[model samples]
Target: MSTEQIPEGVRLAPAMVAGARIYIPEPTWCDVDHASENASCVQDVDHRTAPAYLNRPGSDIESLLHVEGFAELSGAHADPVVMLNDATAMHPAQALRWAKDVVAFAEKVETIARSVMPELEA
Candidate 1:
């Protein structure tokens, strides 16, 4: 048997539901109806708002990620377009806070990465 290794910095969001960690990327907001039913709520994370990580043009980390969110919802899931590359998680909301949070978290990661590998900016 084979199993996929969860990426580094990846973690199960504390606010996850539906017996699954996946959140639907549609709707652009958390579904109170679904949450009231104790179902999964889609948390959209837009990392594009963070310009620090993008400072290093052509960087793999920069191109590999974007402003997006992920939720398993069920056994069937979709690959996250932008992996925060950190262990932080956030709840779904209609405000830009989620997107800002993703960017902030990503920036923190970049800061740590630069501290260890200064060449990351080159």
Candidate 2:
């Protein structure tokens, strides 16, 4: 890939894709341990962010969120998406809007928590 085609903060690195040697862009936030002998780094010609999680209070439930960007060569699915755990995928714009809603809900939760425990700090 040409320097002009690379995204900011990404570096091209050699990898085996579909039994052929190719260079893949690795972003700064990528958590794939490419050095591992058994690493499964490639994901359908896409790069992904490290997973972020939010755990429920007093419960084992945890929610995961991550972003995935498909390589330009990925054909029809070249657009980036925000993945919610393993369940949903949203475009960046949609994810931004959904994030606003999540912030509002979190604020409401904080309010309720404070009402129940006045000394609680968010």
- Residue-level lDDT of model 1, residues 41-70, one tens digit each, is 343332122222332565665453333344
- What value of lDDT does candidate 2 attain over all alpha carbons? 0.63
Question: Where does the lowest 10-residue lDDT sum fall in candidate 2?
Answer: 64-73
lDDT winner: 2
TM-scores for candidates 1 onward, in order:
0.26, 0.64
Candidate closest to the true structure, highest TM-score:
2
- Candidate lDDT values, in order: 0.41, 0.63
- Alpha-carbon deviation at 51 in model 2, angstroms: 1.2
Error of 1 at 100 (Å): 0.4
